[model samples]
Target: MNILPLIVLFPLLGALILAFNPRLPNRLAALVGVGSIGLSALVMVWLNWLFYLGDGGGFTQTLWQWVTVGDFRMGFTLYLDGLSLTMISVITGVGFLIHLFASWYMEKDLEGAPGYARFFAYMNLFVFSMLLLVLGDNLLLLYLGWEGVGLCSYLLIGYYYQSEYNAWCAFKAFIVTRIGDVFLAIGLFLLFTRFGTLDIQQLLQQAPQVWQEGDLMAEVAALMLLGGALGKSAQLPLHTWLADAMAGPTPVSALIHAATMVTAGVYLIARTHTIFELAPFTLSLVALIGLLTLLVAGFTALAQTDIKRVLAYSTMSQIGYMFLALGVQAWDVAIFHLMIHAFFKALLFLTSGSVIIACHHEQNIFKMGGLWRSLKLPYACFLIGGAALSALPLVTAGFYSKDEILWLTFDHGYSLLWLGALLGALLTSIYTFRMIFIVFHGREQIHPHAGRGIAHHLPLLALALLSTFVGGMIHPPLANVLPAGPEGQYGHLIRVLTEVLAAVVALVGVGIAAALFLGRRRLIGNLMEAKEGDRLRRFFYSGFAFDWLYERITVRPFLFIARLHRRDWVNSLVNMWPALALGLNDLLLGTQNGRLRWYAAVMTGGAVSMLFLLLLF
Candidate 1:
């Protein structure tokens, strides 16, 4: 009956059970993970139904007082509102499906090593952390979730830690996120000290009052909080971690990039929309950064030939859309877009995973062609996912959500943002279809050894079907939670226009691929021939040296300083005083003798001096 505890406790219980029973059969362990997640998902669905029944009031369920200080109190509490409830549904619902898919995908991994239980353990723990993030009633609790997810990410990314690069990538992801978390933690402390409370609802109510009273201090506090959201959400400057996060398995990439972590930034902005409302300058910067990041990432996506890398760049670009919405104060529309993006993007990534596994680990598009005939299920899934992403019309999920965001940006006189977003949409369509055409439409450049089986195809089929129709069946209008837009009678017109634009974009993208790589053997050959051209190709392949720039600017400098510290010079000055103090202590001890004769001589000399002073007085 108590839904809040059940939501967090169930996965926690699963983690406990799996951690202890390490010897359980792989299938049985997977079943436990899947079944536990499924139960949690059902509970989430039930809660969603109940929440939907309520008029508009939000709900809070306080479990107990977690800690108490002299005059401060924090609790183990969960807040269920329209925003958090939507997040819960996505985390547990889609999360369960991903777990089910993983049961099959990870089986091969278990054949040589018994990591099945361990994998499930990580998944279950990841779900619990995500729920905490969404359901937390206070900033401290939210930070707990934030750190928890980062820990799970590190563990899962380095799941196959035998590889040096996997381990390095995992560490990079962990440390980079921790950099953002530090700012987030400081912001939380400032909120508590200034407001005397960590409760989110109370802060929202008080922030505006503090602002109206000319509280410069409070505004600075809010800006500090924005820094955290920017980093977590992968806004412009701190966005490099996400691109490197793709170094994990495809499933990890899907869960983190498409469905969960990347959305954290948007959720943070929405959760603290009150703060943004007060700082108009910060809001504008948020929008501008989103616009710039989207354009940059979209161009990079166009240049990528690796299937997963393309999806990774696309994710950065799409999250920019959410930030754009946030900048314009369309918090609800941003959230709506987030929901739809999760469904389709996850669909795309998982389907892409299936194709990779079928191809025996081949990743380059040039190395894959004529896959449509052999990989019918994956092909179908890709098409559906691509359609939704392009926002091709007829009331698909992405169309409704993305169209709303674009319209909101335009309505707010952010014509430039609208234009940038529209171009992003077009580029998204082109690159997606480019991968589709070159991989499935052109010549059969099959690998010498390719494996095809039912295990890989089933998940792809299920996700494909969901991708196509799930967008239409969910809640309608989504107006209750998001800001209310004007209700119009132009439903048919909207649908027609959206469909036409989406189709044109999709066709142009597909047509370009056909023209360049389809039947022109000489063109394709010559393009691949020039060794000098290879250097140019490599530049595109390397993300235009953005990764290198980050390393030189941030990563290398960080490591260099770390090495400098180990050299015992940068910090040796700090030790100088302590070392001098110790030497003085040793020197002072040598002057004191424990013998009675030495003590007597010193006492007699002091007494003689005292007598001389007394005579003078």
Candidate 2:
């Protein structure tokens, strides 16, 4: 039997068992949940080994035919290639780690409603959906996984249903992403009509032959598909939901928002590279959009006070970089960066979770000061994750992947895009380190009743080790995996120089942040006391009112319009028609009153009148 099916089935079984047995003890449910994902991880590793050994080739396992109609057919097939392998490894690997961390992190919450079993059920379902997403061979199958994930996200986001804000956040995320889904559905229909098939591999094979560069249909398909990608990946115009998604559990934050769910958009683009390549205009648009999002989100991160919100915006900004990579056809490079991002980003969120648990759920970085001594493991892990985010030159995983993306932008002659990305990177460094400095480098802020236990620190220690060294280790193989362009069409020296420039920008950003927030505290303090400084601080702190602008310009007005149309003349017209019909029926039936004498007399008169009228005609 192929190991592929088990990868998805194990999680499905786990979800089923946990959902039915919600009354089980928390420890037992936790054991079942983590064990199931761990088993899946081992199977993925085994499959990887088999794939590597099979004549240096890829593998695909088909369970059965999904559907068939004349010339069109779809199958429940799993395709294992370099790309899918990367995603699976991240899903199961980082996913398992997060699951282990969640066990301890959420133990306290099991005392309330929606106990351990329910939490694990959502987590397991998430694993299964993500697996289906990466393994799917066709677009429709992929959509199934896509919708599955959206459902799981809603469940997890509203896990704490007692909080009205959590439910609202879940609804917001659901509605925002549905906007992208509409475009994606249209794109799939267009692709099927044009190519006569939804199989991604086959579509890729035919796209280059059938569609030339600048083909209108290809461009439309790319744009429509990008609409979905932008929303899922938290790009511009559809990115607000991510900041609010922080209302979910901390492990959910680390697993879904940080590592897996957001990366699905990047994977979609990479998986359908041929379509984008044939649509040059669409690709350029993607790059432009990515650049805008990177700059906007990076700057916004600087203003955030909540630790998770800071990381939330950072996720958006980093994903923008990935989209930029995909737009430039750096498929392997984008996936590589995604892999590295998963390690460090998950580590950061987990460490933050530890810090929050230790401090009894305090999340404001301003409220947290010198925690290095009290929370040594979290401090060390946070530093490791922060270093990666700052792209500390050649030492961090982010440096390897993100630097390559910067290099690609310049080498492709996108000078303005490169400059924008550079600025974004600088802002990323400053904001990332700003949080780090505030939370760990200042005066102690731990409360007296806050709990500190071994359960909280172990995950931090494990993730910290991975965050520190994974980037450098992955670099050698990652470089080889990236596609090399045709000679003379590519610019090698420019690539290297651009990497160096990105590194320099990151360093400078870090330096400036250190000087203001750490190195020259008195100077910054004095500046803060000045009236103008207060205004400037408030401006940045409120994210320059981007969220407010969105509400005023888009969300609030759209809702108002919906309410007006739904309640005004149209609704009245519908009600009036129904009421009018009822009145007409009553008037026509009113003559048949149940009085015997009146009824007999009216019948006799009507019969005589009818006889006279017929005789006259």
> Could you say which candidate leads in TM-score?
2
Stretches of model 1 off by over 4 angstroms after superposition: 213-219, 447-459, 476-503, 521-540, 558-617
- The clash count of every prediction, one per candidate, is 0, 2
Tell how far residue 44 is off in model 2, in angstroms: 1.2
Q: Quote the positional error of residue 257 for candidate 2 in Å.
A: 0.2
Model 2 poorest ten-residue lDDT run: 475-484
- For all predicted structures, in order, the TM-scores are 0.85, 0.88
Report the lDDT tens digits of candidate 1 across residue range 1-617: 36768989889989888989878898789888989988999898888777667775667888999989987888999988788888988888778777877776677534558778888888899899989998999988988888888898888888888889889888887877777788888888888877899898999889887675335665666667767876677767777777777777778778876788778878887887777677777778888888888877877787687898888888888899888888887777888788788888888888777777778777787799989888876787788888777676653567777777776776677778877888887777777777788787767888533334554555565556656657645652235444553343345665466456645665576566566656654664687578866666667667667778888988799898988777586478888899999999999797596888888988999999999999999
lDDT (10s digit) by residue, model 2, range 1-617: 27789989989899999999999888899888988999999998897777667654456788999898887778899887777877888899889889988988898545455578999999999999999998998999898998888899989988987899999999999998889888899999999999899999899889989988899999999998998887788888888788999999999999999999999998888888789888989888888888888888887788788999999989988899988887777667788788888989999998888888777789999898878777777777877898898888866777877887887776766778878889999999999888988888777766513335555666566666666656447531223223543232356676667777888899998888888787437887898799998888787666667778988998899999998788688789889989999999998798778889988998899999999999999
- In angstroms, the error of model 1 at 121 is 0.6
- Residue 64 C-alpha lDDT in model 2: 94
Model 2, residue pairs in steric clash: 370-443, 397-471
